[model samples]
Structures are given as structure tokens and as C-alpha cells.
Target: MIENIPLLVTNISYGVTFIITVGFGLAVYLKSSRKTAHIMFLFLSLAIGIFQICHVFGINVVDGESSRSIFTGSLSVIFVICFTIHWVLAVLEKDSEKIKTIVGFYTVAVGLVVFYLINPSAFLLNSVPKLYLPNYYEAGNYYWLMFVFFTVGALYAFYTLAHAYRIADPAHKNKLRYFMAAIAIGFPLGSTAFFLALNINIDPIYSTLFSIYIIPLAYGTLRYDVMDIKVVTKKAVSYALIIAGIGFFIAGINWADTLIQSVYTWVPIWAIPLTSSILAVFIGGFVWEKMRDIDILKYEFVTVVTHKFRTPLTRIKWASEMLKKLIPVESADQSRLAVDEIDNANGLLVELTDMLVSLRQVDDINYLYSFEESDMCKIVEKAARNMNKHILDKKIDFSLVCADNIPSVMLDARRMQFALQIVIENAVIYTPEEGRVSVSVTQENGKVVVSIIDTGIGISKEDIDHIFTKFFRSKEAKTTDTEGMGIGLFMAHQIIERHDGDMSVSSDGIGHGSMFKIEVPKA
Candidate 1:
């Protein structure tokens, strides 16, 4: 039994690694099976899983049979590299014909390596028990060539990822960062096994720790929009933890029975099943809670969408009826009035559509942004100009002041304009007619700041905290603007955040007016 300790430990490590990689791969594939990148990710995971499982058997089998298992595990490395390169290219949106050609050439090289691997004599000399490992193999004449192939493939994949990260937009850059981090941690550590294969005396403990990569990979998946999956909630994380805990608990009991049968004899066998049943109950409750939360979110989303779209749709229908009545007989003024009403209704529909699109994009990993150095003053002026009609219609006392020689900031101009327009338009809409509305641009503390102050129905203290939440309307806002869908501010906030900027609002209370400030770092 004491002699079996190393084999047991090694099996446990490889077994856990196999489960994690395959589990993540399946999750991603189930979420989006059609995506090329996701498919490649699954293949990579399977390759790793195969490599780990092969090692588990290779280390436990008799020395005479170990050579085949180790050789198969070594062969899996080629697939790992192939899948990694394809996955990286797909994720980075570099899947062009030229890239395919390059990948094909790499595949040819991998094929040659496989040809060499098929004849065990070419890649493996023999297997012998070594320091900690149950079976460690010595390298043959061509083993160095396999290592070179693996090294070159890894370097190329890393290079591709790094180069793409440098040029990727903010959102894509964030996703790539997670992938790069995982590679940085896992690949090099796992490569330590190769040193042992070459007859070096180095311990292969780092190879067992390769599973540590899942930490960052899992975190990136849950915390960010990765592989087109939205951010998972804490409840989801709790569910995963509970499941993993149960698995570990059961495995622990079995391992204890095997390793310490004399001590485990006192423990009742029924106790294990009872504890597992309790855990199952806990999981069920947790899953129910998550389901309830999802249901509530869906209901709220539908309510907002339907409530917001109904008004413009009704108006459009009414205008069409009026247009039909005014056909071919009335004065030009009447016909023009109907056409204008239809046009206004259409404009409202377009605005609503744009808002919905922005809402959808806010949490998307693939949202594209084009950043360039831009003038804060010009962007502010443009937004104000766009809201000119609203200002005139409300007859609000509007003023604009811009500081000269303001430093340019790097931002997506169109998105910045949209964000500013939302604030200015809200100021115009919420403030009573003849109330004051002011826009100003200045630089402060290495950042360009845009401020919009208005004598509007000011935000109450209770509502201020939730102002940027999607579909959340303050009591005063609901009373003042029944048509508001409560998405503009949320969209604006997301845009500013993506630009490495922040937005803040201050209000004295419900009738004291409010001020909104946006700050972006200077280019």
C-alpha cells in the first residue's frame, strides 16, 4: 500500500485535470457549438484531457506496457498545438485563407511527427521507474526533434496571441488577456515533463500543477463576456462550487477507505450516501433560486421592451390612418401635417431601435469600437447641436462654455457623441421650460471632463444609486416622462466605461437640480 502512494497521487492529479479540461470544453461547446473558435477550444480541451489520461495509465501500467501509453501521450501534444493555434486564430478573427495555408503547413509537420511516433523506437528508448514517477521514459534519437516542434508551435501561438492583443480593441483585448494569462501559466509548467523524458533528473511536479491554468480560465469565463457567453452570476458560481465540493467529498471518502482501511472501518458506509443526499438537496435548492432569478430577469426585459415599443407603434398606426383619410382631397397643410406626424413617429421608432441595439451591445464581448484622438469641445458641440430642436421646443435657457486648448482624448467619436447626447437630451427633456441647462468642457487632473448641469426634476437620494441600472426609472422621472424606457443612461455609462472613463451624477435633492460629469483620460 505504501508503495502505491505515488501512483495514487499521480492518478488523482491527472484525473482531476482531465475532468476540468473536458468539463470546460463541454460547457463551451454546449453553449455555442457552431462557432469555429468554440469548436477549436473544445478540440484543444479534448487533446489536453487525452494527454492527461494517457499519463495516468502510463504511470500505473507495468513497465513493459508503459511505453505505448507514454508514446500516445506524447503524440497528443501535436494535436494540442494544432488545436491551440487554430483556436487562437479563430478567436483573434484571423481565419483567412492565408492563415489556413499556414495552419496546413503546420499540420503537415505534425503529421511527420506522428509518423515518427508510430514507430516507438524512433521516439522512445525504454521506460524505467524514476525518483517519484512510477514510470519515466528515456528519449530516443528523434525525441529532440519532437521537443523542437512543440517549442516552435507554442512560441508561434504565443506570438500570434500577443500580436493580436496589441492591435485589438478594448473589449477583445480584455478577452485575449485572459487567454494569454492561462497560456503563460499552464504551457511552460507542463513542458517541464519533457525535461524528465530526456533523462534529466528534474522532478515533474510542475506537470501535475498544469491544472492551475483552469483558475484564470474559469475566472475569465465567469467574470467576463468570453466566447460569446454573457457574464455568469454569483449564484451560478455557487452552484459550481457546491458541485465540485460534493465530488471532492465523495472522492475523499473513497480514497480514505482505500488508503486507511483500518481507520475507515469505524465510519458507517451509510454516512457517505446520507451526506451525498444532503448535498443533492442543497444543489437542487440553489438551482431553483437561479431559475427564479432568470425568470424574473426575463419578465422585466419583456415588460420594458413591450411598454416602450407600444407608443410609437400606436402612433404610427394612427398616422397611417390619418394619411389614408387625407389622400387626394385635402389642402396641402393637412397632408403635410400627416406626413410630418408619420415622420416623427418613425424617428421615435428608430431611436428606440438604436437604444435596444446599444443595450444588446453593452455586455457583448465582440462589440467593436474605433478609437481615435478627438476634441472634447467639438464632440460636445456636436451633441448640443443634435439636441438643438429639443432645447428650442422646450424653450430651456441653454448655455455652452468650453475651455480653450483642451487636450485631445482617445475615444470612439461616434459613441462619445451618443453618450453626450443622451445626457444633454435628458437635461432638456426633464427640466421645466425656461429652466437653465448648461454644457461645459474642461481638463482636470490629466483627464478631459464634460459637465452637463440642468434644473431638472432632480434625482432623489434613493434613486441616484440605481440611476444607471437598465430599466430603472426614478419616481420623479416616471412622473415627468412617461415615455422614458430608462436605457439611455445605462447605455451611456457602458460606453464611457469602455473608453476607460467614468460618469458621475450629483443632485441636491428632488427639485434642486442635478449635474452629470464625464471624465476621459487625455491621449
Candidate 2:
């Protein structure tokens, strides 16, 4: 009704472009890449989108009652100013906060224009909607304030883009040159339509129609992997397909009713349930792609478990051979030497076995802890005895001190001992040669406390943040000669947490040593 048949196609194109602008802009903003870049892009997209929406608005927005087309004319002028400023800021990588301030100013300016349009009788800006072709065609207010906002937006954008282009990176300059060219050509051509709409009695539809030239630049922005619009289209198609299928079935049922109204008048009611069931079945079946691949975890699992089994089994074999050679030994010193060596090798085998056993435990989300009513002193002594060979070999000065009032605790004996062994082994592995590693247990404020303090190459600030994270090692430890599979601390954290105990780290950065304080409930 507003123009030739071409205007109808142009209106649809505007709808698509506006939707794309909003969707792409939102993805970039939420993604963790560049907060400044994505946020500026969002502002630019929103401004352009507001203008596009107004260009397609009809008198029916007010139910054909309002005389003035406030949306069509006013929003168009404001869109030019806001869109240009945002586009320039986005291109230049301007300070995000400063650009946001400009956005607030532009929004306030545009709102004033729209406010004056509806209340021309009581304001500085006048509202006037002129009819060029009777009820079929109409044009809205020619407010001067509205045009001022538009000119300001255009000039701001021009300056923004020009300043940004001069400082762009070499890689960015080449890829962005086309988008720059598009802006150079598109904004001027688009702005010309706004100026013409103000003074002349020309068809206003061509203004929106000419704005489609900016799509080339939009495509460039979206295709650069910065915008994740592909994911949106994937979901959108699924919704459309489902709706189309239901619509077809409904149409078929209505046809059946009319064809046999006398014979089967109740067919439409039955079609409702059938349509719902079809939709339910389709959606339930379509979510397989959204499920995680799981292959990455599976690959890491095989690698970890394989190394865990091999290390301990090799130690056990060598330990067994040493015990055989020790039978009917030559000297008193040789026999003592053989026994200590055998203890060291067997200790490694037990640790390796515990390490393997932990892999299976980790897969079980909930395993009841085999809590035994145990003496606090005995638990500490058993752990110390199990780790004696490691202490002597690493020359770590280990000690245990239990308070007189330290209550007996309900603990899983083997698991708790295994937990202590892991922390001790790690401390020995990392501590500088001859640097002391001490294990002490005591009761404090009605809680069992186990402290393992080591003068080791300490954790860095960044490493401590993710030290308990799976398969992660401190950068210093990774670079050092320390041989670790990176699973000991993770398993220890899980075991401690399962027992309602807590573990924490205290480090003075790099060369400064670390301390682990473990606190669990005492029975």
C-alpha cells in the first residue's frame, strides 16, 4: 500500500538484516574474546536495528488512530547518529566505557525527538504526518531536532572510523579495508536518503531500500569467525521445520472436516493430540548433536590409566628379585642394605597400586566411605610407618604430634593412609635435596588437623589457583626435574572432600615453600 511491489521485498530484507545484527552482536558480547570489541559491535548493531525497524513501521502500530507516524520519521534520524558513532568506535577499538557514555547520550537525544513528535502542541519539535496518496500512503513529522540527531550521529561515525583506520594492525587493515569501503559508500548513500526524505516529497521507501548495500560489510564481520550466527540458524531451522509439519497436519485435518462434515465432524479435535505427539517425538530425537562428544575424556583416560599400571608393576618385579638375592646373604651390613632397598621398592609398588585404585574410585560419583571407629594416634602412626622408607630416602625430617585430647576419628583406614602417603610423596618429590618435609597430626578446636609442611620449590600465584584442577601442574614444577603424573593432588582433594574434610594451600609465591593444612571431623 505504501509503494510498488518492490517495497514488500525490501521490508522483509530489513527484518532479516535487523535480526542478524542483534543476534551476531549478542554472541560477540557474551563470548570471552574481546569485551571492548564485541560490546561496541552490539551498540552499533542496536542503533542500525532501531532505524531499520522504524523504516518498516506502518500506521497500524497505533491501530490506525494516531495521525502522526512518530516511529517512521523520528527513529530514522536518530538511527543515523547512533549507528555511525557505534560503528566508528567498534572499528577503532575505542575505550569501551567512553563509547558506552556516547551511546547513553545518543539514546537520550533520540527519546526526546520521539517524545516531542506525539506532543507537538506542547513542545519545541512539531508533529506533522502528510498524506501524499490518500489512505494508502502517508509521511510523518519533519521535526528539526530529529534531523540534528541524525547529522550528529553521521559526523561522529565518520570521525570514529577515520581515527580507527589509521591505527589498525597490519592483518586487520587488509581484511577490514572492504568493510571500511562499505561504510564509506553505504553511510553517505544511506544518509542522502534521510536528507531527501526531509525536504523533498520523494518516495521514502528507497531510503530503506538503498540501505541493503551495507550487507556486504555485515557478511564480512559475521564470516570472520567472530560472530557465531551459524549456531542460531541451525536452531532456527529446527523450529521452522517443526512448525511447518504441524501446520500441514492441521490443514489436512480441516480439509477432512469440510470434505466429510456429515460423516466425521469430530476429526479436528483428535488432530490436536496427534500434532503434539509428533512434535514431542521430533524434539526428543533431535538432541543427539547437542550431547558432548566424550571422546576427548576417553582419550585422556586411557593414557593416564596405562601409565599408572606400568610404573608400579615394574617396581614390584624388581623388588621381588632383590628379596630373592637377599636369601643366605654374605654380611650383616649387606642384609640390612637389602631389607631397606626392598622396603623402598615395595613402598613404590603400594603407591602405584593406590594410584591405579583411585582411577576407578574417581569414576564412581558416590561411594560410601568405609568409616571405622579408629584411634587417632594409631592412624597417624600407621601412615608414618607406611611412609618411613620415603622419609629416610629423601632425608625428610618427618614428625607426628597428637594432642592429649585428640579424639578418636571415624575414618576409612586404607583410604586415609593412602591420602597421607600421596601428600608426603609429593612433598618429598618437590622439596630441594636435604630440605625438610614434616608430617604432624594434632587436634585443634575439636577437629583433626594434619599438616604436611615442605621446603619445596613453592607454587606460583597462577598455579595455586588451578593446582587442584585435573591434570594441571604448577609451571615451576613442570619445568623442574620433578617426575609426576599430575593426578596425586586431584585424588587427594576428592578423597578429603568425600570425608567432609578440607584442604588448602599457603605459598609465598615461587621460591617460597607451600603448606597443606587438612582438617577433618573427629569422632
Candidate 3:
């Protein structure tokens, strides 16, 4: 049991890492944003956490296979199976948008539960006893089946993460790359421990080695924000190597203990010191990286801060220049000109402030808002007129048609305008030169409906649900000359919801035109 220290440490570390990862996944889920990748991510984290906890604490952790353990461990089977299916869904699913990775994962989850529920046989527990080892804690013969399933599940989970890590964009590439690398290293190590536990090797030392993997996992997650993965993996590798070094030290202590076990019941139990030394060695290197080379965080921080200052600075300059020219002719009406010029600068300032606020709020997925009353017709016209230059440049025959009986609605004017702009801009982006883009408004069932109908490359049904997702662009969107950030529609969706409105998109399939319908409650 003493020899199991390193493995226990590794397992505990993995368990901690798993907890944080799952928490992050849930955070994204609660934000009214849903995506296959994120949902799969949540399940994967949840399952990994569960497995790590089981390994670290063992099934009899609380009271050695007590009824509580059975219940908890049994419940974990569902999560494990779901994690596996999360991968299978990704592997088999051709449609990127219509996938329900979570709900789909749960299907396998149910199967796992039902099988165990019907048969609480040896696969789950050999004997429900108060103590975990030496007497009541022999693994059931059918435990191999569970091991088989778990192995398959872990493989699929890792596979999905691996694929995601490879294709993620630069903004997130490094974090994901390291996170996946951590998973890659730990999963294999974990597998080795699993096989060893199953009589492949009856050594307690394997458990210690397995437990130590958690340090790397935790380091990857904490040091690099691997959950929100960005590019830059040097720190992650450093973290892993630290874990490796610490692992060796722990191994040394285990060796020392075994030597003493040959002579005495125990030695000073020096593994903790060795573990700390390993951590210190790696962490020392981490500190050195910041001093010796460029840090990505430094660059990101500067970039974000500079953008804040630069945009407003440009706006202020433009406003000043415009005022300067006008003042040369209109300076005689001093007070009036002064007020107008100040208002111009103020308006730009207000716009900049609002942009920054929205940027921050948008990061919160669950952001909701208060609604105000405004004219739908005016809103559509305003958005179109605002982007008139873009319309002309694109050669899009943009038009706004409103039914004579169309009514005003209760909504946030600024938000509605933003939504309208996104939809229109998206239409313009998707539409080819000379292609027509029509914005039509109508009153239907006590609602004001604004539709942006484009005669451009249409979205397929499979891709429609994903259009409103953050950072989700269709293959078509990627191929076009359109330089899109893919957040326009997502932002629009949030804004519409804040206004007590609803937005939906439809496309027949590939090459068919798409329509974005936004409906807000009539005032």
C-alpha cells in the first residue's frame, strides 16, 4: 500500500484536472450556447474526471465497496460510456451542425446503466466490504469487461481530443495542442496502470507512477489555460517534463521503501520530498522560460490593450479632422458649431464604449438583457442605410420592403440595429456581385418579423443550426472571399434574445439560398 504513493499521486492529480475541465465545460453549456465540440468536451472531461477519481481513491474509498461506492461507481459507468460515445458520434457524424453529442452520449450512457442495473455482478464489485484491501477487495472476474469498455472509451475520447487539437485555429491552437498532449501522455500511462492492476502486473509501484501523471495534467490545465486552449505549448511541455522528473524521484523513494521493506516495515516515507523536488525542478524551468524567451501572454495582453486604445484614438482623430474642416467655414456660429463637434466626438466615444462593453459581455454565454420599444421599419432602414457603402461596394441590390400594416415592436434599439447589421452584412458577404439581397419586414401574429433573404450561395439544412454558433463557419463560408469572424450571427442571436425576440435560419441544402428570420414582440 505504501508503494502505491506515486500512482495515487498521479491519480489524484488527474482527478483534480478532470474536475476543473468539467467545470469549464459546464460553464460553456450554461451560457445558452451549444455546439458539438463543446458538448463533447463536457462529456469527455466528466468521464475522465470520474475515471481518475475511481483510480485515485478506488471504489472502496469511502468505506471499501460500501453500497455508496456501488451507487457512485455504477453511476460513473454511464458517464464513462457517454464519454466514449461522444467520440463515436464525432467519428460517425457527417453533419457538423445537427449533432447532439451530449444527448447522444447519454444514449450509450443509459445502456451502460441498464446493463449494470440488471446485473450488479462481479463486473462492478467483487464483495461489498468495509475495507478496500487484503480481505474484501478482490476485483470481480467480469471486471475485465469493464476494463475493456473503459479502454475503448478512453481511446475514443482521446481520439476526439487529438483531432480537435490538430485543427483548432491559431488563437486556441497552443492551449489545445498542449491539453491534447497531456491527454495523450496520461491516457497511455493510465492504460498501462489499468492492465497492471488487472494482474498483468501485481506491483503496487505501478499505482504510484500512474498517480503522478496527474501533476502533468494539472500543470497543463492551470499553467496554459488548456481548456480555453490558445497557441504556445512550451510551458505545457515543461510541465510534463516536470511531472516526468518528479515521477522519477517518486520512483526512487518507492525503490528505497521496497529495499527497506526487505529489512523493515517502513522507512521515512520520503516520497513527498522527492515529489516536491521534482515539481521544483520543473517549476524552476517554467520561471526561466518567462525570463529567457518571449511569453505569449505578454503579446496577447499588449494586443488586447492596444486595440482598446487604438480604436478610440482613431475615432477621436477622424471626428477631429471632420470638425476641423467644417469649422473653417462654420466657425462664426461658434457655440452651435462647438456643440455639434463635441456631440460628434461624444457619439463616437459612446459607440466605442458600447463596443467594448459588448465585447466583454459577449464572453459571458448566458448574457440576457432588458428590452425597449422601437420601430421595426426604422430599425431595418437604419441598419441598411448605415451599411450603404458596403452594399454599393459589393454591388448587392439591397432593398428593404415593409408591409403597409407592419407594426413597431418592443426591443433594444441598439441591439436590434446590431442584429440587423450582422444579418445584412452576412447576406452581403454570402451574396455574389450583382446578386440581390432583400430585407423584408412584416407583421405576423402580433410579432414584427424582419427577414434577410439573399439570392447567394445557400446554406444546407445540416449547417443551419450551427450558423448562430460562435466561431462556427460552414465549409462554404470558409471557401468564400468573405472575411468573416463567424461571431456576427452568434452576437446577433444573443442580441435578439435580449430583445425578447427570436431568430432562426433556414436553407434547403447546399447551393440553395438562405433566409434569416428575426421576430420580436410588437410593442
Most lDDT-accurate candidate: 1
Task: Estimate the overall C-alpha local distance difference test score of candidate 2.
Answer: 0.60
Q: Write the per-residue lDDT of candidate 2 for residues 412-520, one digit (tens) a residue.
A: 8777777777777678778876788777778887788988888889987656655665567766888764577676777777778667677777788787778888888
Q: All candidates' lDDT scores?
A: 0.73, 0.60, 0.59
- Give one clash count per candidate, in the order shown: 0, 1, 18
Q: Tell me the lDDT of model 2 at 251.
A: 50
Candidate 3 lands at a TM-score of 0.47
**Model 1, TM vs. native:** 0.52
lDDT: worst 10-residue window of model 1: 224-233
RMSD of 1: 12.5
In order of appearance, the predictions have TM-scores of 0.52, 0.45, 0.47
Clashing pairs in 1: none
Model 3 per-residue lDDT tens digits across residues 350-427: 544554456555545665555666778987887787666567778888788989977767777776776787789788
Model 2 Cα shift for residue 455 (angstroms): 1.5
Q: What is the full ranking by TM-score, best candidate first?
A: 1, 3, 2
Clashing pairs in 2: 81-153
Residue 70 Cα positional deviation in candidate 3, in Å, after optimal superposition: 12
**Candidate 2 Cα outliers beyond 4 Å, as residue runs:** 1-267, 282-366
lDDT of 1 by residue, 327-424 (tens): 75456655655565565546545555655655545544676678999898998998788666667778899999999889999988977888898899
